[model samples]
Target: MATLNLGILAHVDAGKTSLTERLLYAAGVIDELGSVDAGSTRTDTLELERRRGITIKSAVVSFPLRGTTVNLIDTPGHPDFIAEVERVLGVLDGAVLVISAVEGVQAQTRVLARTLHRLRIPTLIFVNKVDRAGARFHELLDEVGARVSPALVPMSRVDGLGTRDAAVTERVDLLRLADHDDAVLAALVEERTPPPVRAHDDVHPVFFGSAITGAGIDALIGGIVDLLPTGRAPGRGGTVFKVDRGPAGERIAYLRMFDGVLRVRDTVGEDRVTGIRVFTDGGTQPRAELTAGQIGTVRGLGHVRIGDTIGVRDAKAQQAQFAPPSLETAVLASRRAELHAALAELAEQDPLINLRQDDERREVYVSLYGEVQKEVIQATLAEQYGLDVSFRETTTLHIERPAGAGAAVEYNKVAPNPFLATVGLRVGPGDGVSFQLAVEPGSMPAAFFVAVEQTVRETLRQGLRGWPVPDCAVTMTHSGYSARQSHAHAVFDKSMSSTAGDFRNLTPLVLMAALRDAGTVVHEPIHAFTAEVPADTVPAVLPLLARLGAIPLATGAHGIDGEIPAAKVHELRRRLPGLTRGEGVLESVFDHYAPVRGKPPVRERTGPDPLDRKEYLLRVVNRRLTPSQSST
Candidate 1:
């Protein structure tokens, strides 16, 4: 049987876990169905997830359906947990996007669909909760088309409306026919046609069912077997999307194989892989050989990191198909009265998460998505890492311009050993946003130049105001250092920090926070939602949108005009209590960091340093001065 590695994803509380429960039960993996509200869902096993009744961490489960082994990666629905979604997309060959029937397509649904589309993962849509009250089948299908995909395949149609006793009809062939283009459309003009395989359909397969009442599950299961993609082996190699703490704190990486077969104890070169773990709805089992195009976990690969590819001995010889994004921002420890050692260790575990300290700002920043992510990092530091950590709001790294032809700063200006070097430096914008730095040729030893390069990176650990130094280039044209006095460590400090400071001073515009700017406007996350409440509730909800700072784009014309509302996170959290009121679930993603219009409000700053600057100055001067020079 073909192993189909598919992800079960949706907006939070869109019944993804519940559907998984039902799918598992139907496949006899579970004796009974687990509930999400009650927190018995298999995928939502984490303590934080269980307490909140959401999927914070991605869970892996597999089951058999019609001779196909369907491996499902259940991911978190809340926007805060989007990293889980982004990481999972790396491994998934395809995805089953669940759109709540009662709520139709929501803001998060649209965001996730866009991401899936970008990842080029073939998708299958599931319109769930058809048995719920206020369910509008046709209207919901229309919303799917408008919001998610125009080529959505609607396989099963509901017999009745809302909770008026709905039954699923086997309309797979009709939906598949609708997926074809005009040329294919003309072929369908004939009386009867041989039903094309699900893969041949130009559109994604869309199935309808109520996960709660188990309505239409069997047919949906059958469709999954028929429509889902199939593959025999892994690709050339595989990419590691996420690393999870397994039983006993063992690091188990959930990976997707792209092109090569992975066996037990196989090494990604010299890195030894001890074993492979396979998870299913029946719980996790062991596997020996996972070929290309498969998803499995490798055990005891200590050297493996996220985005690492493991395959044949000469796998690197094979052209790499997957290209992971490079590290954008670097975050480090905050400089306060005290430092936390645990925080440093946390940063060490995730090399993608780098850290550097800035003596000038006396702060450490850990690069992240945004301010909200900063808050999450703080929480993680406190709760998981057992440390009291705080963060300054994130700022992007910016580059510095050179004084003239080139610029270079030397370390060892004082006591430790007086090593001095001055090399001209110039900074200019390159092809992209990152600035390029160039150094003068043969100005310093190959060893010394490498030290300079390392320093620049460290200096970027904390830029002028403690933010990362953005992309920029630096060139050292002419530099000289004391042959006897300059050490590798000292040069590293001076070069990096000085270059960082120079860049900061030369450039007037520091790296600004990446606000969601589009055209002449900045856009914040606006939840494009469709809520199917009673007609009486529509008027009540419309006013609530204004209170939430959301603009109602349009309301559905069918039964209860469901409006696609766009609202901010803070406003939505506050207004959703009264808006949802046991009526619907809301799904939204980080739309764009819209701009704050007008003069742009200035931030309030705290004045007066409590700590003596003299103390810091003394440390700097004392470190720089030599004992013999002090006497002189």
Candidate 2:
């Protein structure tokens, strides 16, 4: 049977989770429908999610329909938990972008649609809540076509819309899909049944339904089988979208295979798959193997990382289709050590949190998307890890980029370079962190070169101003190594031969000098926001937004669309409800980074500071400093 990994996604309160429940019930996987209000939804398994009546984690459920086993991933709708949605995107064979008919098109709705279009994932638009009052059908279609994609084809027309008796009548327009391709157009002209396949990006089919009353679900199911792509691809690797800890505290990796087979006991990359649990029509069944186009839980990959490839990799298997957290908050806790330890483990599951420590001040910091995410993290730490932590005010997470090209080199046995290895590097701006070689591969031992390159990257983590320098082009300009020299008698000797550790110890000093010469400028995160508010509140809101350094560009019936610094997003959110009498709905997404207007905020240097020459030499070369970072 063919398998399809479908995603059920929407903005918060758009009924995305309810739709997931309805699909499961319609497929007979569940005897009855589960309610989001009652906190009985199958996909919302987390207690936190039940209490908040929102999806916090992306939960996977499986059901069978029309000879296809569909693994429906119910992803979090909160933009705060969008990292969950981002992880789920790369694994989807097709998606159904849900919109609230009463709400029309929302800000997060627009974001999701744009991303789906960019990825060219085959998508179906579902205008939900047709049974609710204030539902608008034709207007929503016009809005979707104008604001979202104009290539929308309505598969069915709504009858009795905006009432409890709402129904969907089948009304396919074969001609509407003609513009998607010439072949389909020619087939239509010749009165031939055109090929059923449609371009994922070019043409989109729209469905109207209500998850509450189960109206129009049959048509949606048909769309799933008819419109979506089935996974039967060739190749031999999978993408790891999620990771969890087992009962024994071991890592459990949730992998979606793009192609080929993976069996228990098979070695994939550096780890072996010791156990497998495939999500099938009847729920997770422990199995000996996992095949192409299936998602499963694999155990015993002790070092498996999220987004890392398993087996021979293809481009789709390793694409970093994720974004980094743009805001960070300092966690203040009485049990600071425990909080740090817990955050470290949490970081393993969601690496974007990027736990960092201020060793000197004994403080812990965690990155976040917004205030809601900070709340979730606080709640999680309190309930799950038993640590009561309060976060400081959120701040923009800044990063530094190399200002200019600079080069530096240290020769082996030189006075300042005490290590018995020579390393050289040139730093400059690039698309992202990349390392190339000016020296031949045969110039030194591969391990030594590996050591130099690794240290160069590690050193760049905390640049001259202590902000991360993740984007730069680094080239290894020179290399030298001590030949293995030993006495006639085969005896252990450390003074004669250069170890990888020697290259590691000396690389920081050389790379830091290059960074000093190159210089850097700190860039702060900027976000674009769309706010839907009462028409009367726009006058009051524009000034408040302007005070927070927002540039309001367009004004619609809802409110204003503009760009604001990410640092001000929380403030905007806090003040908007009051200004609009609790009717204002604001959605914001990270746009880009611009140079800070004034002095950039500095994060206290952690581990060893390579910029300090005497301290770095004393700590690294002489081994006088306590082990800051174990590179050897």
Candidate 3:
């Protein structure tokens, strides 16, 4: 059977999960309908998700539609878990974007719609919650056209909406509407057969429905099967998008097979698939094989990580970059030694939860999107790992960039160098952090090239500002190794040795010297935000935003667009509700890094400063001096 990978995306509380449950019921995949409020939905199985009535992670479910298999991916609508949505977007053949009939187009709705459009994923819009009071189809449709895309054409019109028996009637020629490129229209005029809807087309077919009452669901499903295109055959390669643990504590890699078949025990790269499980109406069933255009879980892939491509050596799965975590908090635990171990497990699930250790402070820090995510982490630890933990006050995570350009060199064979390698490098500002090994033939053995390049890239992790450096370029202008020379071993002969370790050790010293000469500037992450408020409150909100260093973009009758420092978003979130009498809507997304205008707050250093030559060398090379001893 042909397969289709469809994603369900929406703004928070827009009935996205409800819509998924309805679709599953409509397809007869489930005997009874599950409600999001009751926490019985198939896609949302997490305890935290059930309790909170929100989807915290993307979940995949499959069911038969007509003669085709539809692999549905239900993505988290909450902005905090947007990373989950981003991971699934790379694998979708099409998407059903859910919008609330009552709420009209929301900030997140626009974000999702624009992203789907930009990615060129053919999308259908579902105006859900038609049963809710204040639901207006015409107004919502206009809002969608104005806020989302103008090319959105209505597939049907709802009569007696917000009632028990709302009826839908076909309003447009779907074949023509789906003919976004006018190919179908041309075919009709030329007396030739019109083609099926192209999945990459810009035109979006909008469907009106109430997911709760199951109104207008059949039409939506029919639209999907008839209008959406069946994807090409899967390739042998696929990307691991999620990692979980089975009942036996074995690793489970959730993958979207792009091409080729993956069989049980098939060795893809270095990892072997010990087992395969494909989703079915009756839960996952063990499968001997998985073909292309399928989403399934595989076991025994211990080293596989999110965004890793299976069956392809050294290939990286391309995914949309998520916004950097703007806030961080210290993890407070009584069992200090076990904290890192527990966090490592959490990091395996959500790589965005970057865990850092502060040896000097004897504390653990974690990156976060906001306070809600912090609470989730705290709860996750207590529930899953049985480790109770609290968090200190949150703080901003700052990054640095190069201010100029310079060069440095380290000759390992010389006295006091304490190694058998020679390295030289140059540093300058670039669009982002990057490394290149520019070497002349015979300058170094071919075997040493990879080691030298890897070492340089690793060393760039730390910069003079005590944060990961960004927007800088490093190139290895020179590299060498000591010739085999004999030295007295015991009382007569000498020995010679050359290893990659020497190059790795010397890398820090040379790179730091270059960074110091080049100088560095710190930049803080900023966010572009939009706020919808009462028309009368726009004036009041303007000055408040200005006080927070926000630059106004546009002032509409009931909304304002602006940019603000991400660090101050929490303050805005706390105050916006009361200012607009609970009717206001505020949305913020990471924009770009801007240079700190004045004195910047200091951040805790992660490692020894490379500029401190003697201390760094003693700490890294000698390994005898403790952190305190080396500093002293």
Tens digits of per-residue lDDT for model 1, 1-632: 67787788898778898888888889888888888878787777766666667776777888777788788888877765566666566666567888888877766787788777755677778888887888877777667777777775567778875784678887754543445455445566765564564632237777888888888888778777877676522346777767766657666777777676778877666666788876554666688877665577788876556556665323322222311111123334444533445445554344434554444555554544334445555666666655566555344322222112223232334332222444333443232123333544454455555554555444433322332333345444334453434456654454423333233221221111111010112212223444444455567777766655565665554222223223244454455547546564443433322333343222211122111223322343345443453331
At residue 457, candidate 3 shows an lDDT of: 68
**Root-mean-square deviation of each candidate, in angstroms?**
8.2, 3.5, 3.8
lDDT of 1: 0.56
Q: Model 3 clash tally?
A: 13
| lDDT of every model, 2 decimals | 0.56, 0.84, 0.79
Q: Which ten residues in a row have the lowest lDDT in candidate 1?
A: 510-519
Over 1-632, each residue of candidate 3 has an lDDT whose tens digit, in order, gives 88898999999999999999998888888888887888899899999999999999899999999887899999998877877887787777789999988887776787788788777777888988887878887777667877887666677788887666777776654443434446666877787875544345478888888888887788788888888877732335787778887777677889988887889988877778889998766368999998788889999888877878766422222635456677889999999887888898778877878787888788988888777788888888888778899889998888878889989876755655665778788999996667786778577776666776676666665678677675789988878886555556534222256666777777777788888889888888888788989989887888889888889898876498888998888888788888888988888877778887788666767666566766777767765644443341
- Model 1: residues >4 Å from true position, as ranges? 173-180, 190-202, 232-235, 246-248, 263-271, 287-290, 311-588, 593-632
**Clash count per candidate:** 55, 0, 13
- lDDT at 592 for candidate 2? 79
Candidate 3 residues lying further than 4 Å off, grouped into runs, are: 162-165, 173-201, 232-236, 313-317, 414-418, 445-447, 483-496, 623-632
What does candidate 2's lDDT look like per residue over 494-607, in tens digits? 898999999998898888888888989888888889889899999999999989999998998768999998888878999999999999988888777888888877867887
Q: What is the TM-score of each candidate against the true structure?
A: 0.69, 0.92, 0.90
Top lDDT hit: 2
- Cα error, residue 368 of model 2, in Å, equals 1.0
- Candidate 3 weakest ten by summed lDDT: 312-321
